[model samples]
Target: MMPQLRTLTMMRGTRARILRKICRNCPNLTTLQLHGCQKMNYSLLKYIFEKCPKIEKLIIANNLLADRQYAELVSRLEHLQSLEVFENRRGAGPVVLRFLAATCSKLREINLSCDYHPLEDVEYFVKAKRDTLTSATVRWTMAGKRPGCLPLLQKLDLPHATDLPDDAVVTISRGCPPLRHLSLTFATSLTDGALAEIHRLKHLQILDLSGCSGLGGSAVAHVAQLAALCTLLLQYIDDLTELQPSLRHVLDLKQLRCLDILYSGHIRAVAFEEFSVRLVNLRELHVTYEEEDEVFYKNVFAEMQSQMPRLRIINTFRWTENDFLTDYETDDDDDTDIGY
Candidate 1:
């Protein structure tokens, strides 16, 4: 009497016996989302995957699934093309990831989040020999450098996984030669050494180095070298005392469409003519300042509009300061990060 559903979502009170009975009837289900569930019994997870062998996407968030059960997920979900897991319990470790690399041959996208980050575990996942990977997102993980190569990878997002050093950047660059989108927001340990390595990503289009306090404007000169960059995010950086001068070097990146510097509190003011004159393709501009610099920003935006009319300014006239849409938890170390 019930419809042949392809999606199943349950938030709480997902009992093992009840799930067993339900999964048996949903043989065609391709997506399963378990949200905010306190207890994810191993039997239920195994039974669901076993019964629904055709699943393509699986999301497990804010739940208490044991380490073995998470391992069960990687081993059982062989047909999964997408997997999103929020392992707040530190269940997603090296062993689980290594198994995933060996078993999930068709996997393409993975978003992995962790709490109380285990660096070795994440390193194993990143360095594992997964040949089909293209997009990978990581959060609160202490992932290390590459142990192997990944030639086909394209997009990598690691907003707050801690302890990524410059060497880690170079390693990932050498490992994943085709990376295009990279986010290393708040990676405070990265220096110009890391930026120097970033130039190797010749195809890189979008880059987010916000809140990386250790880097200087001199270090940012390499970012300008990325000719293909379309979106550049340098928001909330605390140590950029020489930002204005560095703006000149990036004028060559004419393909840029979006630029964010709204919360880079250390940057006092940037001359419009220095940037707007060369950024003919720019569409969005995000900027913030001390009370003294508000007038400076306004005057520049006004002059820029007169010249390059297509540019869009965010929260310009009525400046209301806002937090980063997504800032994360991390510690002081050197490396890049991404989460799912």
Candidate 2:
């Protein structure tokens, strides 16, 4: 029996009996991840929660817990601070969310993406936990109105939120004033009007607008207003043309460190070279080009790297979805240090 064990992860295929033994043995565990573990059931989960009373971070992604069972199971963990329970059999509804808002006073971070739930229920939970929650990841279904103010919220990730609208961006900007990190990845319906609202988040550091095809050069112009921005992702923005003229606007962001422009073919080599020269603080640059334009970008990037000596030019073609998943997971883990 490893009584001193602090963290345990059972990735998959662990039998119920083995899990019971492990949980019984590791009573002092603080972080337990059962991602993709197919054998989990209500009785085993109840036993594990009772045994691991000190757990602060729990990840049960791809499990088979029903909404009520998940709510009941989580309510037992009074010390839980961070949770990631994605792609469950039945998505959490008002019962689970209300339970979290009312009982989980220590909960700080939650990721429910890929789960089917109404936007209004999530809004209620966020409003109730506004003072404690710093980071949140949820799917947007366009069924809710503007959310209430979340004064302490810092990071809000709505990846692949295809139904997000301009008014919602305005509402979010008005609500989350101290936001530092915002990811609206693949929200293709957003236009420059939404970008205008996003610029209101003056404290924003990392902004990912990947796959927002409705935006043009004006979007960059709006992003340039965020003086604190460190990382900017514009991957798959097909309409962001006439970019050379707007490159000058981005130069105002002296703190910009990482810029991703993968699959944005409108950016010419000359414009990229000109922009790269002035961004002295830039450390990483991600770009992708067709086979025909490969040599052109290679020469430009090579010269830029030679001149800068500290820049890392990455080819987006080499990256996979797991890369992003790992990054987001790491971010969630790091946020556990925030005091409740």
Candidate 3:
């Protein structure tokens, strides 16, 4: 009777014994996710592959194991749809991912962000015949950058490849087309010229250039041309003069929702004043504020309530070391008052 039951064994602490029994007996079980458990090993995986003939989604995230063990696991899990093999080290991710891509046939989405590598040789997982791969996120330190081709990709999030030159950026930009969400944090090699290539992607909805310190006004302006954009996260972008050129095109983005401008001390009061009026569609705004203009954020928040009713999350407060210490002291005060 247990062999007929499907979709069991997920997110419970005491169900270890029950799951083991089910896996030993159940032939109908398909989806299995055993994350953050120390007791489980390759034997458990071997049992599932040996017993369960049908498997669609197999997630074994954050499970520390040797490279050989991981390779063996991937080879055995032949019918996986969604595979997440995130590792603690940088090189392990690519090693495991390459092995899985070679082993799995019907994968749809994969997340390999823990791998600390530069945009190294991208693992071409999608089959040439045709596939249902729609979403993927790969984060790596600057090891190396190369042109990658994923035919059936819709959503992609990559690390800031500061080492990648214009040619490398161009290679990636050419490969992925019509992307919905794009993030390029700490991509130091990117310049205004790379922005031109990005403008070709008309389907982009979210753009995050948080640590792109080199992006000038021309690039920002080019990015603002994408009318479909809803969220923009820009942190540590020191180039202030170029913002006006970028902001000029932002007024056209009617669907723009959230903006996070943390640590951009270069932004003047005039920029926010103009930005507040132009960003009628913005729901959340985070920016730097001088000690003198502390009241300005409050005023802007009040005015925005009428037009930006969706503004549920607002961070108009300035971030300072003193503020951090004060908050820490307040927390300590509460802890002391409670006699902890």
Candidate 4:
């Protein structure tokens, strides 16, 4: 018996017969990832769920499952803690969410794809799991408004939430005080006021404001106030012309490790130099430059890497010979390079 087999990942085209055998043998399986496994049916899933009663983390992405099937599957996993269901159109609706909230008392992390549902339903689930939930990723339209608190919640990712407003942000900040990782990617309606409200999350560590077109320099200024921040993503934020002077405020974040400023063309080279020099704990820096500034930014990255040996500079452009010639360099490394 493969009792020690705690994790299993099945890619696309996985056969149900093989899964059945594996699950039967691995009774202690704690984590299972079935990505793009189109062949999965309710009967097979139910069999696996019964066999692997110890599953604590389950990721089912890009598959097809109905709402009733989803509810049935989740009802069996009494030990479930982290659940992620992405790109599976029909399964993750109000019925499944409410069912999970009621049955999965130990559920802590939930990441679901963008689905149209009443804001009240989402709020109900959040309220139900408030004490146990630590991380949540649910993208719903802003059709309703309510005030609720989740004191134990740490991470909240609301990517592509186009209609997210300032008042909603205020409510979230005031409610979830201990939030550490907050992602508001493409939350276009948010402005400086929202950032001001988010500043109150004293323990915040990772902040992603990528694709947030409405934010300006003041937003950055508010972000700079979060002393505990380690990773900051400001990609696609076009308004940074007035940020040059207040850029000094960012240097105050002594614990910052990763900073992404991709497509933020307004920040000057001198400012980048200052950041590379002053931010002692910085380990990764992501940036993009215009056609004319390509060579200049390349040189700046090289210089930054030279000064901070531990720092990894990333950009959309291909790495040149003049860039850091590290031992891990390989031919397969393309523009979207992953640094060690």
Candidate 3 C-alpha lDDT tens digits along 158-189: 67566646555565567767577777788877
Give the candidate number with the greatest TM-score. 4
Cα RMSD to native, each candidate? 9.0, 10.3, 5.3, 7.2
lDDT of 4 by residue, 107-173 (tens): 8998865463446667777778888889999874665654458888899998898988888888887
Estimate, for each residue in 1-340, the C-alpha lDDT of model 1 and write its tens digit: 1338899888675667777778888888888887654466666667778888888987775243336556656466767888777754443333356566667777787776554234565566655635677878765344344454677788887777456778777777677778899888888788778877677888999898887777766665778888899998988774346554665566778898998886666554444576666888999888766665677767767888877788888843323434222234444373445433
TM-score of each: 0.73, 0.83, 0.73, 0.85
For candidate 2, write residues 48-106 as lDDT tens digits.
Answer: 89999999998875334335776677877878998876674543433357666787889
Clashes of each: 18, 0, 6, 0
Off by over 4 Å in 2: 1-7, 61-70, 90-95, 242-244, 316-340
Model 3 scores what on Cα lDDT? 0.62
lDDT of each: 0.70, 0.77, 0.62, 0.77
Worst ten in a row by lDDT for model 1 = 318-327
